[model samples]
Target chain A: MSRPKRQLMMGNQACVQGALRAGLRFYAGYPITPSTEVTEGCARELPKTGGRFLQMEDEIGAISAVVGASVAGVKAMTATSGPGYSLMVENIGYAYMIEAPCVIVNVQRGGPSTGLPTKTSQSDTMQTRWGPHGDYTAIAVAPSTVADTVTETIRAFNLAERFRTPVTILLDEVIGHMQEMISLPEPGEYQVVDRVKPTCPPEEYEPYGSTDNFVNPMPAYGDGYRWYATGLTHDAMGFPTNRPDEIVVNLDKLRRKIEDFRDEICKVRADWMDDAEFALVSYGSVSRTALLATKLAREAGVKVGCLQLQTVWPFPLAQLRELLQDCTAVIVAELNMGQIVREVERVAPPQARVHSLLRYDGEILTPIQFLEKIEEVRS
Target chain B: MTTTAESVAEQRRSDVHLSYLRPHKKFPNLWCPGCGNGIVMSSLVRAIDKLGLPRDEVALVSGIGCSSRMPVYLDFQALHTTHGRALAFATGVKFARPDLKVIVITGDGDALSIGGNHLIHACRRNIDITTILINNYIYGMTGGQVSPTTPSGAYATTTPFGNTEKHFEPCDLAKGAGATFVARTTVYHTPQMDRVLADAIAHHGFSFVEVLSNCHTYFGRLNRLGSATALLQMFKEKTTSVGKTEESANGKIPIGVLHRDLETTELCDEYQKIVDSLSKGKQG
Candidate 1:
């Protein structure tokens, strides 16, 4: 790749760049604090790429439109914050059931309901995966910095198209609004995945037909594959089914299709994990501080390492378990009240003393805080 | 695609309207016998047939309701979405491919109460999607509850003490929200409904057609309105249509096209202009 275009830009603007580079042709979103920049950016940039952008009346309408566009075989996305994300959870479940490919960006602000509007909060960690009521699986990615936001967004689109499911990019106010200097990815720098199209003739095309990869090909609406899509449990023929056997097959496929490729879907990056006795685990903006703590702790003659979890919901359990297997103590740094720390507890070695460095005061955790947690665990 | 029923296939050869339906999926449909939903469905299918739009280019989006079940029985790009969200989804489909004829099938509660915000904004945007709001006055699929359109003093399950709420005139809402084409027709008026719906679909911007359907099982029985046939007869007597009238409908729910503004810009066409201007800007 001829050296990626180096420039400085805000995180939300980079996300739009990534989405446009991945060939997103349709976008519908509502403005919500901390995430409104994403919506505003799409409105400004989408038309430049010959894509259509709409500001919906609410988050429900925005996400509903996004799902509709995806079902119509267009790469689509929407962005919002806490209250809006809650409103969208209903349609998010519908998107999951219908197996539509789209990306949803949630630049989190604090909330059970309209918490801090301008501050960063990772309080929506579990909500992103379980917000929608159902047994359907979810794939979500968390990017730590402004530059990586571009690549992570492209990856989110790829994963959504690959699994034929709606994927989420969990950003917080800090990363979403933070400005950074970096080069944009060159046009062939990253692989882009488009929605799979039917290779068979229209007459034989089954919208939910089982293929070798488990994801059935989906065709654009006007492409002559006039198949059915519904929020109800549907059979392989794309028709709603009450038959227990067909219903089980329908629901099971959603979970199995993504889980089968778990190893490929889950991404965890390890730093200095060769022989560390103390490990710090984190993701998104929190991971940046976690990594800094690991470095400072090493200089201070303490053997500490950091594991950044890029893929939040396929949980990355096996990788976390293996990397933390040798550690005597594990510290989980999060901007929430111990959300992913529970995941760390599940995988930490039995002898490993797990500690949670929690902060949910509408502010991000610092490296000193992580360092303090490790020191406290030692005492 | 589902397997075709042989009998259904045989019936298609006998009737041109049968060709518009799905091969076998929910062949008989789930609506009760003599339900007005069937009549509206027939009228909608006939209008689509008259338009000669290819099934491939047609997308029927519906929310959850008895009336919203219209899409599953038809052979097109059918999407049965969440309750009260059909228009929102159809907006996406229309903007994504303005070439595709996107039509939203919704009911009174689905369109007015829970989905009311979307409907108002959709009309305001003047998006190119034909919305058919089937007003049965009560929620038929769910046990008869007091929907937003349940007439004042009408009895519903939730309104067993008789309704204390005023009702909504759907055509008025459509016109007030800036829909380019707005119409009201009863299921009893099939010829009027078919022609009105066809004209609405032909209109360039957002089109809303209110179909006054009968829910004899709950709405009619609870109100002591006699049988489904009696409700159909009532529609014939209660409504008056004189094409476009500025006068108060003389206390009648006026039928036929209530409002039409063909010159108003459609959302899709305007978006296309923006897209064209940008591409041209890039070239220049």
Candidate 2:
């Protein structure tokens, strides 16, 4: 392996680098603040590698194009902020229905409707899983630091291709714009997964045929296996169908592909959790503050630890319950109006106390504020 | 032993069917009987047959509409995407695999009302994809709602009082949006529709063909336009050749290729040029 090189880079720029390393060859996106850098980086760099980048008319078109490219046998991605993410909900659902593998990055800004373009928020945590209407499984990952952003983006694409589903990377404005020194991974340092292709001849190939693992072999367009793909509920042949049995089988495949492989799909980082009274749960940028807060709390003789979630969706419930079993209380710190805190409360042991430390006023949660919340919850 | 004109025409029709259509998918299509969409589909299939292009190399993409269902009956790499997003998806397919012939089949509302942004932008980019927009003047699949192409004073379910919105001239809109090739034809004129679709598919840049199809189940019944056959006959009488520049009496609509620009660079080619220069610059 080549030596890793240390470079100063923005988190968004690192994401672009990670995408390139993960075999992404097509990028389609529109400019949205806090995430525009990702698009700009791809535009400048993708062509040099013989990959293509398109600045579509809107977020909807951007994601639609990404889905198309993915179906056409290219690893594809798009980046957007809150407003743009909202616009992409329908096509995201379409991707899920059609089982297209692509990565979507939401560098979240505060929003009900373009609420804060330049400020940071983790308000889209729930949106990442539930934004698209219907019964389907979703995978979203969060990265707290610039280095983690690259690694997590690579993981996102791998999971997307392996599972044949859309994967989202949730970044806040803080993580997106913050500059940090990071050691870029050498080639082969991380795993890269491409979708499985069909071994059968063109006549016998089924695009959505089920295997022992839920994912079917995906044939690229013009691969002589010219099968159908649709957003409508479809059969194993990828043709639209309204039959109850076929619909149930199709929807069940989508859910089970990720759910059954939760252990392999979910990633979390634990700090000082072996012997602790208070456990702090956080993700994305807030995890940085939580880490500092845990350090300060330990300095003050308050036995506290942090659980930094890297994979936000697939919930990682089993892991959370196991880790929080010995702790007396768990504090969920996030830069939103208590989104993932509810998940913490739902999964924590019956004896463990659950409290939320939320900051939705367009400001990052400081370590001091986290300490105060810990004190309040402890008392 | 001589063949009559009718017999020769019948023989050609069967040949086109055998060559272009999927044999296993039997005849009664999803469209309502006498729906002009079937005629448009046949014309499209005939166009492909005439070009002698490999079926496996072509991709048919569509959004949700009665007209959009045309792809399931034919044999090609097909994508039935979300409502009103066929062009956007088709853009991706074309960009990724420029060698594959991508054709989009969309209807009035699917192309104009909800998917209008993608339509105009696709035209502006002049991407190398053939788009056949079937303008039935109303939303048929949704049961006769007024659409952007529904003529003013025409009646639809949503426009029971009368449609107050002016209809769009699709060919003009495509030309204004920078489509390299634009044309208009009626489903009644089968030979013209087939010829125009072939030319559009053969164009090296973005091409648009607006087929004035009849939604006999919705638009016709609402407007009291008689039977589907009567409406088709009306199309033949009320439309003038685009070559006849003089306005026919009673405001006859023009039918035929309205615009063509063979010199404009296609989007895919332009993108490739950028990639080439960037790669060369890196090496030098």
Measured by DockQ, the strongest candidate is 1
- The models' CA-based lDDT, in order, is 0.90, 0.91
Instruction: Count clashing residue pairs per candidate.
Output: 0, 0
TM-scores for every predicted model:
0.96, 0.97
When summed lDDT is taken over every stretch of 10 residues in candidate 1 chain B, the lowest stretch is B242-251
| A220-338: candidate 2 lDDT, tens digit per residue | 88887777888889887777778999999999999998899999988889999999889999999999999998999999999999999999998999899899999889999888888
Model 2 lDDT, residue B168, Cα? 82
Question: Model 1 segments beyond 4 Å from truth?
Answer: A1-4, B1-14, B243-250
Per-residue lDDT value at B63 in model 1: 97
- Best of the candidates, TM-score: 2
Residue pairs whose backbone atoms clash in candidate 2: none
> What DockQ class does candidate 1 belong to?
medium
